[model samples]
Target: MSKVVLITGGSSGIGKSIGEFLTEKGFKVYGTSRSPERYTSSKFPILKLDVKVVSTISDCVQSLLEQEDRIDVLINNAGVGITGPLEEIPLEEMKSHFDTNFFGPLEVIKAVLPQMRKQHSGLIINVTSIAGYMGLPYRGIYSASKGALELVTEAYRMELKSFNIQMTNVAPGDFATNIASGRFHAPVNENSPYKTAYGNTLKLMDSHVDSGKDPKIMAEAIFKIISTKNPNVHYKVGEFMQKFSVALKRILPDKMYEKLLLNHYKL
Candidate 1:
């Protein structure tokens, strides 16, 4: 039988690309959306799921299990983006961002674990961001949330090893997607102290996404990882410099790396 795969936030963007690619490769793929009805034309089925809601996560997993009888792979790709100065972004918004980006994926993983354990084999891939490796000026909240997930996956890999389940993080750099449109942006208030700097950084961030590499790059990387017998704990997909930046952070002094970021954002 072909492997059964579940992807969260698969209605569009990177998740959609992965689902479609896997489907063409003969994997039985299912994708989730907060509004499934909106994606009538998707190549794979779009189940209704809101990662922030435990009940929806449970229902979606149950529904898929009922149909496929097994979930060989779970892609925790459902996440939202938030960009703003740390102080200026509302506290509630920050919490909400965590709910979707961090807690949501955790809940989905929890919902699927029992079944995966019963099968004695499974793979869980958490879709994180390149920004997760370090704090970016305006996208601090996004960095924190994704970064937290990256760490959690490391712990999960050890715990799940005996059960024959594998967990890994795939952090993608900026990809050409609709993420910018959906991201929560704190209004650029003219009188706010961070108005000018925040405004410039925000524009630069969107431009990067606009000119980002194709989503298929992520799809290919994911496919390779899935086929590997002993996958690494973390994999990054993006432009050479974007991936190199992570290495630079490891080798550079704290102040030097900070300076590079400041210069890049022109802060």
Candidate 2:
């Protein structure tokens, strides 16, 4: 029997790519999208779900349950990016990012965990980013959200290990996705604060994203990962990110590593 996988943020980009990829392999995929019409042509089941809104989670899960009776894999891939000076970004925007990127996944997990525990088997793959491991200028909010999810995923895996629930943290390096070009007017600012200081760093992060690796590479990596019975606690895709973090941790001194990061962003 083919396995049933539920994915959040499956409307487009990496999330949509993974959903289609898994569907081709014959898995029954239930994918959540804010705009269900956008994915009317997708291979898997498309359901309307806005990750930022907590109330929508259970309804979506219930819809999936009616179809498959159980969820074998739950992948949290929904997230948003707000790039700019952290100080300039409003507190409400910061909270919005956390609510969507972190708490959204937590809610989904809480809904599905009981079913997995009853089945005595399941896999949870979180689509985090390299920013989770290392702080980045201009992307502070995004990085912080991913980092918190990483920690939560760690505890979730530890506690669920006895139930045979496997967890994998997928940290993709810069990937060629439409995220950098996505919608959003510049957030309204109460006042122009730290304008000059944050300009260069924000430009640097945007440039790095422009030169990111292909998203398909990361999608293929995900396919290989879940196919294995014993998956690693964390998997870093893309050479640019894998080498960057590993080298920083092993070769450079603490101060030197910090200096390199700052230099990378021309800060």
Candidate 3:
């Protein structure tokens, strides 16, 4: 039987690319969106799900189970991007970001665990960010949320090992997608101290997304990971420099790595 896969936020961007790719590879793919009605023409079924809403998460899982009987893979791909000076970003917004990026994924995983455990086999892939590995000037909250998820996955992997269920994080660098338009940007206020730096950094971030690699690359990476018998705890997919930055952080002194970031952002 073909593997049954579920992907959150699969209506577009990286999720959509992965869903389409897997569909062509002969997997039974189901993607989720807040507004599934809008994606009637999607290659695979797009179920209604909003990660921030627990009820929707449960409903999506139950509905899929009724149709497919088993979920071989669960891709926690639903996340929103947020950027701003940490101090200027609203407290509520930070909480909301975490709710979507961290807590939301956790809820989805919980919903699927019973079935995965019953089957005595499954894989859960958390789509994290390369940015999660470091705290960039204007993207600290976004970094923290994803970073928290990364650590949580590390812990979950150990707990699930005996059940033959696998959990891993796939951190991607900037990928050409509609993420920039959907991302939250705390406005740059003229009177605020961070206005100049925040504005410049925000522009740079958008440019990176605009020129990023094709999302198909992420899809291919996902496909390869699913085929592996023993997947690593973490996998990164991105440009050389982006992946190198993580390696550099591991070897460089604290202040020196900080300096590199400051120079890159021209702050």
Candidate 4:
């Protein structure tokens, strides 16, 4: 039987591309999305799913279970981004980001783990971001969401290794995805309590969205990881700045990194 792979948020962006690439390689692809209409001409199943909705995830998984008894891979790729001064974000906004980006994946894991455990073999890929490893200006919540996921992936890899099931954390750099256009952006006001501290950096980040890495590159990387026999537990894929940024985050002291970030953005 052909293997089955499921990707959340697969209507477009990296997930959509991964679905297409994987389908071409003979995997029975399941692409879950809130807006299935946004994706067209894929030779795989496009299921209506919204990660923020637990029922949506469960119903989608349950439907798949009835048609196919096994799911070989689960790509926890659905996420939402909230941008604003971390200080000014409403508590609910922060919680919602966590809901879509972190908790949502956990829900999917629980829904799918029974089958994976029964099979005694599976791969779970968590789509993270370089920001997870390094705090970035105006990217605090997104960074936090990915950071939380990274740690969880590590723990899962350690725990699941013996079971022959595996976990991989993919930290992709800035990429050309609808995430920039789709994120919830809190209106900024210098007079707002936290804006004065992060406004400039946020502005810079907003401007860079147009010229980051390509979504296809990220998709190709994800496809390879899913196909390979021995993919790394942690994979970083992107342009030079992101690589440099991650390296600096690892080598520099927190205060020094702060200084560099502030000076780089003229904050």
Candidate 5:
């Protein structure tokens, strides 16, 4: 029997690209969307799932396991973005952001871990972002959420090693996707101190994503990662500069890195 792969947020964007790519490679692929009816794929079946809802996550995994017997790979690619000034952003909005981006993936991991542990072998790939490594102007909450997920991926690697279950955090810098359009923007205070700066930086961030690399590149990278017997704990995907900037941040002085981010976003 072919190895089974389950991907969340597979209705479109990077998740859909990866699901289709893996299916073409002969894996039994299952993809999930809030409304499966909106996405039709003959090669891989779509299941209804909303990462924010624990019941939907449990039901989705249960249904998949009943038919496939095992899930060889679980990709936590379902997430949402929130942007605005942190100080002015409402607490509820931040909670909602974390619900989808951080807790959502955590809940899915919980739902699938039992099956993976039972098999004594499986891979969990959490799709993080380059933003996870640093807090960006006007996108601090989104950064914080991804950053939290990245930390969990590290801890999981150590904890699951004894069980022979593997985990990887795939951090993509930017990809051409509808994420920008779908992102939730907190209500901005007109008189906030950083209002003008926030708006300009937000615009720059959107443009950056608009010109990001194709999602196919990320899909190809993920496929290669899956084929490897022992992949790295983390993989960074993006253009030369985007990936390089991550490296630079590590080596640069704190103030220098902050300046680079400010200049990049025109803040």
Candidate 6:
């Protein structure tokens, strides 16, 4: 039997692309969406799932296991983007981003881990962003959320190693997707101190995303990660500049890195 794979946020974007790619490769792929009825794809089945809701995540996984006795892989790919001055963004709004981007994936991880433990082998991939490596102006909340998830993945890698379950955090740089339409744009009123700066930075961010790498590259990376016996702890899918920026942040002086980032955004 083919390995069973479950992916969250599979109705569109990177999630959908990965699901299709895996399906084409002969894996039995199951993708999730809160509203699966809205989208359709051949070779992969869409299941109903809302990552933020623990009960829904449990139900989805249970349903999958009922149909197929094992879940060989769990891909936590559901996430949202939020942008604006962190201070100006409402606390509730920031919570909403975390609910989807951080906590949501955690719940899904918890849901599938029991089955993985029983199987004594499984792969879990968390779809984080390069922004997680460094805080970007106007995208502070989004960065925080992805950053949090990356940390969780790192911890889980060690915690679950005894169970033979592997965890990998895949950080993609700006990707060509409809994330702009779904992102939460925090309020930036005239009185806000970072109003102009937020606008300029947001514009630059959008431009970068518009010209970002294709999603297929990420899907291929994921496929390889799953196929390998011992995949690296972290994998980045994007242009050299974005991936290199992560290394740069680690080695460069704090002020120097900040200066380079500010210069890139023209801030």
- What's the TM-score of every candidate structure? 0.99, 0.91, 0.99, 0.93, 0.97, 0.97
Worst 10 residues of 2 by lDDT: 183-192
Tens-place lDDT per residue, model 1, 170-217, is 999999999999999999999999999999998999999999999999
Cα lDDT computed for each candidate against the true fold = 0.96, 0.80, 0.97, 0.84, 0.90, 0.90
Give me the runs in candidate 4 sitting further than 4 Å from their true place.
Answer: 37-41, 193-199
Model 6 steric clash pairs: none
List runs of model 1 lying over 4 Å from the truth: none
Candidate 6 residue 248 C-alpha distance from true site, Å: 0.6
Lowest lDDT 10-mer window, candidate 6?
36-45
Candidate 2: Cα lDDT at 97:
78
Q: Give the root-mean-square deviation of each candidate in angstroms.
A: 0.5, 2.3, 0.5, 1.8, 1.2, 1.0
Model 1 lDDT, residue 224, Cα: 96
Per lDDT, the best of the predicted structures is 3
Candidate 5 local Cα displacement, residue 238, angstroms: 0.1
Tens-place lDDT per residue, model 4, 44-128, is: 7888888788898889998998889899999988887788877777889999899989999999988888889889999999999
TM match of model 5 to true structure: 0.97
Candidate 3 stretches with Cα past 4 Å from truth are none
Separately for all candidates shown, the number of backbone clashes (residues 3 or more apart, or on different chains) is 0, 0, 0, 0, 0, 0
List clashing residue pairs in candidate 2: none
Candidate with the larger lDDT of 2 and 3 = 3
Give the range where candidate 1 is weakest over 10 consecutive residues by summed lDDT.
79-88
Q: Write the per-residue lDDT of candidate 2 for residues 140-190, one digit (tens) a residue.
A: 788898989888888888899999999889988777677776622244344
**Distance (Å) between predicted and true CA of 198, model 4?**
4.2
lDDT (tens digit, per residue) of candidate 6 on 122-159: 99999999999999888888888999989988898999
